[model samples]
Target: MKAARGSVVSKKGVPWGTIISVVAVVALAAVVVTYYLVQSAPKRALASWAPTADNPDPSLNIPGIVTGQYQASVHILPTERVAYDHSPPYGGPHDGYWAACNGVVYPVAVRTENMVHSLEHGAVWIAYNPDQVSGDALNTLKSKVEGKPYTMMSPYPGLDSAVSLQSWGHQLKVGSATDERIDQFITALRTNQNTYPEVGASCDALGAGAFDPDNPPPFDPTPPGPDAKPMDYQGSAGTQQDTGMPSSAPTS
Candidate 1:
């Protein structure tokens, strides 16, 4: 009888070991799944922040939304040069040529007029003050701009704010690179047809020669003409200055 009892006890031990092994495998899988979800939390949050059809206009009465008497007309100049009212121009007359908006990260400042052209093509331009942004903050902004079609970023030497985000007819200034509104602006305006002045304009169709991210046109800090018009498209062009626009438009 003792021998029979021993056999039954040994059989019970084998089953218990198998059950433990199964539980261990399941627990490992659950941990891996949890880790991936945690890693993707921020991206998921950004995706969820996107504007829907009913709420397409996120700029309306949105605090920090740039509202002013800026121009909203389109003028194509023979040159890629423009005299803009805003330092990081919202929109107005732009160079006939547009910067390549194919997810380019311009290390140096790009011409404001070329950038405005990109915005007209449904691109979102992000500008930051070099003196104010660096290290992780700068990298975070770069990641947002890099390899994402219809997006471009460049440093503005004399930006009135630490960072400014511009889309056609829209602008937002923020004090930090990690500001929640940064993502909000990108989500609300990036490729939003309702906000575009030229819908279906090809952002990538612009020839590569117009802009080279690695060797972009250096930012010219030359001040705009004394006759520089306010940010109005309907407003007539200011007398062409021999030099580029101002170092930065005075922020209201």
Candidate 2:
């Protein structure tokens, strides 16, 4: 069993936790929103990494879901000269992902400061489709390459969003992969059947995360409830910063 997030949460604003609701988790098409909570921890704050606001590569069509605004823009980034500054991947036993771009193979999922820094942590891979992306957007993206390399990441609205992911872990809200591996991953976290070691993905699953479980809940893999609302949220970046995009590497 993983240690409770509260135990690691620092008195400072840096919290390694903020129990995520089932809706948000499903919405993100991820193992759980526990990732946010984990980053809140002080020890975990500078743990990952953030990149230079610039890089020079445009082939990868990216999108920055400006949470403050409902709009998304196209951006670009150069990945060849990457670096890791802080901690490595958080969750234990998480799978590593891989992808192929123009006949090139790259590790899509692996926990590291470089992953988060490049905003390449959760990039998705979309089978190249020209119509999915307009010509104007593509040309504009290329033009912005060197001056603001990472700027091309944010694709304009209506590009099916997940159009570019040459580098990160792509967070999905809903659709397609839901019934597949996503559901299974959530199920494991819901019940004690699985554990994250660092992040707590509880849904009162183990009796509200056990204040201090001298004797924790039994290991049961069933989900709490189909439509469970973990809790209310006050902050939601209306637009997804890194989402529903395709990528060359597997998302961890």
How many clashing pairs per prediction, in order? 9, 50
Candidate 2 ranges beyond 4 A from true positions: 1-117, 120-129, 147-252
Model 1: per-residue Cα lDDT at residue 234 = 35
The whole-model lDDT of each prediction reads 0.73, 0.25
Model 1, clash count? 9
Q: What does candidate 2's lDDT look like per residue over 104-197, in tens digits? A: 1111222221222223322222211234444664443333232331221222222243233322322222222212322222221111211112
In candidate 1 the C-alpha lDDT for residue 38 amounts to 100
Candidate 1 stretches with Cα past 4 Å from truth are: 1-11, 59-63, 67-73, 78-85, 205-218, 227-230, 233-252
Q: Can you write out model 1's per-residue Cα lDDT over 37-113, one digit (the tens) per residue?
A: 99988788767556678777666545688744333334444343556756688777665556778788888887787
